[model samples]
Every structure is written in C-alpha cells, then in structure tokens.
Target: MPEFTMSEKIYREEVHFTGRVQGVGFRYATLQVAKEFEVTGEVKNLPDGRVYLCAEGAEREVVAFREELEDRMSPFIRESEIKSDFRPSSYKSFEITR
Candidate 1:
C-alpha cells in the first residue's frame, strides 16, 4: 500500500459585507456558521454598517466557509468585498467581537 499524506496551504481572508448586515442577526448567524467549519477568527459589526469577517484556515475550508456564509446570509448582504493573503494563524477559536 502506498502511503498518502494530505497537506494544504493555510490562508486568511478579510471580508466586508455591507447592506442590512447589522441589526439582522448577521453576527450571530456568522458565529453559527463558523462553528460548523474548521476556521478561526472573528466577526464583528463595523460602525459604518458593514460586517467585518476575518477568518483563517486551510484554503479550501476557508473558501467553503465563505461560500456557505454568503449563501446563508445572502438576503442581508447587498455588497461584499473579499481580500485574501497567506497569514500565520493566530486565533484559537472563532468569535464575535464587539
């Protein structure tokens, strides 16, 4: 039997979602979705009425998590901007920041 190993590059994504993102359970819903994925970071409501999301994990997992989040929160998200880069993971768990 051939030995197999799995390795994936980890990355961090900073996403800003605007529109009815604040005051609509957006942060709570994001927290719930974060629990289902293997990513770590935080989500918070910005003063400018945008939801700021910072997540770091395996590239594939992070991407999937983002996609799921967008799908689940589509109704409240009118505009979204994403920026990604290779960053050392620094969070122990996902959280909602004030």
Candidate 2:
C-alpha cells in the first residue's frame, strides 16, 4: 500500500463496469462504498447497460476503494474497464448521478 500525504500527488480514475450493473442497486452500493473512503466523484448508469464511475483522491484510497467495491460487487460485474490519470481534483464528495 502507498502512503500519500497532503504534499503528495492525487490521482483520478475513470471506470466503466459492464454486466448486471444496471437496475441492481449498483450505483447506490458504490456510493455506500465511496463514503467509506476518502474519494470524491460520481457513479451513474449508462444507456448501454454499463455503470460509469469517476473517482479522485489519494491514490491509495482510490485504489483501495475500487478493490473493495469489486470484491463486494463481483457477482454483478462481468467486465470492468479502468483508465487512470493525474488530474486536479474537481469534486468535494461522492455521488450517484442519473
């Protein structure tokens, strides 16, 4: 695990999850998990039956959050595509968007 300090870098990840992700409380569950971590961003259902998520925070927290979420929701997720980048933080909290 990586320890991040206020002076260290923050990372952002854009994730798209496919499978039984829609209509299965996926976004709500993701929001619940997000609250447990120090991450900020949003989760929403796409029209193509995928769940899209954007999270930004300390790199360790964001990665841990994603791992825990996947562990808890593995039964519903068939495939996940993740893209990560370095960017300035833009969200104050995590949310479930439409």
Candidate 3:
C-alpha cells in the first residue's frame, strides 16, 4: 500500500482579473468558490476595474482553487494576471472585502 503525503510548500497566489470582473457579483462568486477549496484568502473589486484574489494553502490546493475559480467565472474574466510564491500567509477565512 502507498501512503499519501501532503505538500510541504505553502503556495500563495495573487490574481488580478480584468474585463467585466466588477459590478457583477464577482467578489461574491469568488467567496463561494473559495469555500470549495482549502485555501484561505480574500477577493475584492479593485478601483481600476479588476478583481483581486489572494489565496494561500498547500501548493496543489492553492493551484486547484485558482483553476476552479477561473473555470467558474470564465465568462466574466477576459484576462488574468497571476503572481505565485512558495510563502505562507495569514488568513483565517476566505472573504469578499470592500
């Protein structure tokens, strides 16, 4: 039998989504998607007409969270920019920020 091992890296991602990403429940939708993953972070509407999402967790989990969120909100996202790191962040829960 093989045993599963969790990733030692705590990956963090800061994603900025553009095009129709605001004024359309983007933040709320992001919050809903975050609940489906182990990642903890926040999503908010940027003043420059973009949606900002910051998520951190196990490497795979964090990546999966971004993938799922992108898939779920593809229609509203015309483009996206992502910055990733193998660092840890403190976020007690996922949320939609003002």
TM-score of each: 0.89, 0.90, 0.87
Residue 65 shift from truth in candidate 3, angstroms: 1.0
lDDT per residue for candidate 3 within 1-98, as digits (tens), equals 44434453467899999999988888888888888889898898888999999998887888898999889889999998999886546687888887
Which candidate leads the pack in lDDT?
2
**Clash totals in order:** 0, 0, 0
Question: Candidate 2's residue-wise lDDT over 44-76, tens digit each?
Answer: 999999999999998999999999999999999
Regions more than 4 Å wrong, model 1: 1-9
Question: What is the total number of backbone clashes in candidate 2?
Answer: 0
List candidate 2 stretches off by more than 4 Å.
1-9
| Candidates ranked, most accurate by lDDT first | 2, 1, 3
Q: Give the TM-score comparing model 3 with the true structure, all chains together.
A: 0.87
Where's the lowest-lDDT run of ten residues in candidate 1?
1-10
> What's the candidate order when arranged by decreasing TM-score?
2, 1, 3
**Residue 21 shift from truth in candidate 1, angstroms:** 0.4
Q: For candidate 1, write residues 1-98 as lDDT tens digits.
A: 54433333358899999889998999999999999999999999999989999999988989999999999999998988999987456788999998
Worst 10 residues of 3 by lDDT: 1-10
Clashing pairs in 1: none
Give the local distance difference test score of model 2.
Answer: 0.92
